[model samples]
Target chain A: MLLKIPLAWLQLARQKIRFIVALAGIAFVVILMFMQLGFQDALYESATQVHQKLKGDLFIISSQYKSLTSQQSFPRSRLYQVLGFEGVESVSPLYVQFSKFKNPQNGEKNPIYVLGIDPAFPAFDIPEVTQNLDVLKFPNRVLFDQASRPEFGPVVENFHHNEPVSVEIFPYNGTVGYQVNVGGLFTLGPSFGVDGNLIVNYATILRIFQDRTPEKIDIGLVTLQPGTDVKRMQAALTEILPNDVKVFTRRDYINFEKDYWSVRTPIGFVFSLMVFMGFVVGVVVVYQILYSNISNHLMEYATLKAMGFKNKYLLDVVFQQALLLAVLGYIPGLIISYGLYDVASNATQLPVIMSPNKLLAVLISATLMCFTSGFFSIGKLRSADPADIF
Target chain B: MNEKTIVHIKNLNHYFGGKSLRSQVLSDINLEIKAGEVIIMTGPSGSGKSTLLTLIGGLRSVQEGSLKVLGWELYGASDEKLVQVRRHIGFIFQSHNLLEFLTARQNVQMALELHNEPDRIAKVKAEEMLHAVKLGNRINYYPSDLSGGQKQRVAIARALVSQPKLVLADEPTAALDSKSGRDVVDLMQQLAKEQGCAILMVTHDNRILDVADRTIYMEDGRLFKEVVL
Candidate 1:
């Protein structure tokens, strides 16, 4: 017997109001889910900016550092010690400090992180910042994100509370501070959360922060030479470094960072809950709409049954209708979600990266919702007897 | 008398509800419809005429005795088999039962399509059936746009398009006026004789009894008597 899927679709298409309502309900849920997915990704990108760009073969940090973005600091001496180990090609010392920069336009001071790096190093740690070094070479100049410039002006004073916003370096043995000058701004996408970042040369940082010990630094990025076994190098370095230090390969660290944020933060949970709610809402609304439509057309369905349509054929009609509504509605919902993401990103200063992975996840979730909603009505479809019409 | 019987019911019994409040709808009923016969089942309301029709059409379960349509025994048949039996037996309801969404032509074509006939052939057959019912000018009109008599004609056309071995119609002309009702019954009898298909129609209108090849009177869930005119 021929299935009536096409006939069911045609029937749905004829009822313009019902068709539109069902489609819009599914689309609304899909858009809600996509937005939540974007927000979760944005949070992760903001928290792991340095980790993503460093792309190091290995990360050597103090064992006391629970997370890559944690406040733990280590000694600069570890870099030289790591370099002495066989198979180690290069080591870069990185300093991280937070300070406030005054906005020339609004006179408002925005909190910012200043990343100190050595230009002559291999620059493997942060190619994005190091490749654009000309902007950093200008005196009192620093690179700021284009997205952050609206709040903080192109130039600003370094003074806070009648004193230069400078702090003493622990290991470099020098005072480190500088007047702020905005250099070229670039897009870092939605993954980096820093509103304003200051990139400066290692020498400039050391000159400003005085009385810092040369052996102590905040973090170190390590690269292995060609054909060098990273595991062997890590083992060799472990012997010389103090018990307080730790070593991790690139893949291990990325997984560790992702796991850390996903487990330790409420952001992941909140987004997951939003996604779950989106599914529940989608199913409920679509189910209610379909159930009502079916109930309204109960007699009609009985008539079809009387005409010798198998229950399976009747169910195929319902599933086909649901599938069509989901796919048709998802298109507009995806477009609306992207537009909303842009507006929300600018308004909240949060990165809403709409990556392929995130989009795929949202689409799958939406289709699953439609399937579930359509599935919920199978029992009713089977029990609808043609004899009941009399 | 030797003609093949398209439908045969023997001691058929049906009951509604359970032990505490059981009610019999059909009891000890025996009916036989032969090829090329136009049979009318007449009774007052609640006399089980429609119930007997439903039983023979495979729309209701046969609770007690044997019921067979087109040589397929319904009591022992699976639901799938019952549906198969129904495909060869066209049915018309009092309410017309035409899909409101489909045009008159499309409505009639639905049965043919369900039988897996090619679309081109199904459409041509549907159009021819509608034309025979004198609905040629209203092919594209939805049920909502058709008059009562026109809608009934469309329903009749749909029933006949499948070229069924048997046709079961319940109160087919009850909702139409005298002239339209006569036209519908006359057309149904003529089509039954022309196609050599057995037709069993349930109605209370005694005025159309002259068109029936055989008439069976039902009362209190059993065949009360028979009339040959």
Candidate 2:
């Protein structure tokens, strides 16, 4: 029975134009579906990169903050109280602010999230952040993403000329202008949402927002010494922290960020709708192609039935053809998707990463899509009577 | 005839059209075909010979009587079991009914494949059957690539490949020229005699009736006469 599958596939290949067209249609749908999935993944990655890179046992934020990606503010002084709790090894205050940046040369403006942190944190606590610590610590300097350089308005031009650019920064509380120096560049993995970020040291941010009260900070990252139970420490912090503050495990923080983008944001809904549409279109195209093929060969099918070939055999042939079309189209579809992802990432300043798991998911979904289309036509095959051949 | 009946039809009647204007196609059809007998069924157009042949072949339901093929009753047999019976009996069509996708050799091999035979053996046997029908050189040719005579020969080869106990042919030579039609009828008669497989053919061609061991003439939905040629 399995040997016949290849034979059926060969027969499908013999019909060159129809097979190619059907395969291309399925591949087109699959590529569209993969892009949707990739976009969704990029959004999630963007929203959680900072939280994920911060290797803390627990995270302390304002209780009003539903997720790490949100703009809830806590008192900067709360970091001291968290450090005073039992089992607390160290607590770091982190500043997160969204600012509008203008390209000093092009004058093109874009929104960037400025993450301000101390350079003295343990390397293990913020592994990826430590890599850019030196560049970020330079006075009046900011580390912009290499991928986002174009949107940041000719930072390279300003750096080459050894000139400082007076850029205005709005810290929400007040707006201030500064002659900021461009430091080195850095890059991070593209998650589904949070992209286009700038990293700078605490002093530069403080100077830029000099008039803002230091009482309010965006969030706090807490690390426990070895042999400390992180869950217990989180519980203790939650009880001791003020009602306006919240504490979470590191894993919980990542989940919160993921849930925020996937559930709270429209990005997830839009992509999901697109994926569903792709699935429906794929099924419709494949089903029509197969149904038309069967109808064209109705006499042949009847003769086979008259020759005593069972209905099951007829179904096997239909399903084999569907699967063959799916696989044939999927190869090119995957290639096209990778190329599209690259082009879209460069054009939109979004990070789109394709992983083995994502590819596997796409392939499985494609196979299922083809199979379902084939299954939908089983009724027509079963109703095919051998007597019709007479 | 030693009274060893391969096909038994008793009081079989078939009708067409709705109840208000029903027309009988075959009424009180009592037939007993013995093994190795070449039975030629001859009739004019619309004489219901093809309908009778279909009934005997289990391709049509016996509405008012019993039809027994190889000792198994077919009148009320389950559809699945009837298919099992059909696998042991070969049917050849007027149009050759050869799958256009398959080559001449594959057309015959398909029948053997349906019977669950080993592929290598089925292929070899199909080649032998094609050779028997004098179509050995056209094994790789598709039906569309073959002439009318060659296509009919391939159909015969397919029907004979399974070594069925009975062979039913409907207008096996209808589309062929005179010489080709004679050749097909003669070959069918010869094979029937040599293989000892009972043959029932429904044909309108009267020129080849001389070769039939027995001939039955049908008209107006009933057996009109039996002629021993």
Tens-digit lDDT track of model 1 for A100-202: 6555556556656666766666343455466667756655555555445456653333321233333212222223334554554444433333566666665
Please state the error at residue B117 of candidate 1 in Å: 1.1
What does candidate 2's lDDT look like per residue over A1-390, in tens digits? 324213466456657788888888999999998999988877777667677677578887887887654677878888898888778788877777766676676765566677777767632344445666776656777766655536567665665576664555555444445556566556653334344666777666777776545577877888789899988888888887788887888788888878877788887788889998999999998998888777767766776777667777888889988888788889999999999999877776666878998899899889989899999977788667766455
Q: If you assessed candidate 2 against the hidden native complex, which CAPRI class would it receive?
A: acceptable
DockQ of each: 0.54, 0.41
After superposition, the stretches of candidate 1 with alpha carbons farther than 4 Å from their true spots are: A1-5, A66-69, A77-81, A122-128, A131-141, A147-149, A155-193, A202-216, A231-243, A341-354, B1-3, B19-22
How many clashing pairs in candidate 1? 24
B134-217 in candidate 1: lDDT tens per residue?
989999999999999999999899888898989998888889999999999889988888899899888888788888888999
* Chain A accuracy of model 2 expressed as TM-score: 0.88
> Residue A11 error for model 1, in Å?
1.2
Interface RMSD of 2: 2.7
Q: DockQ winner among the candidates?
A: 1
How far is A29's C-alpha from truth in model 2 (Å)? 2.3
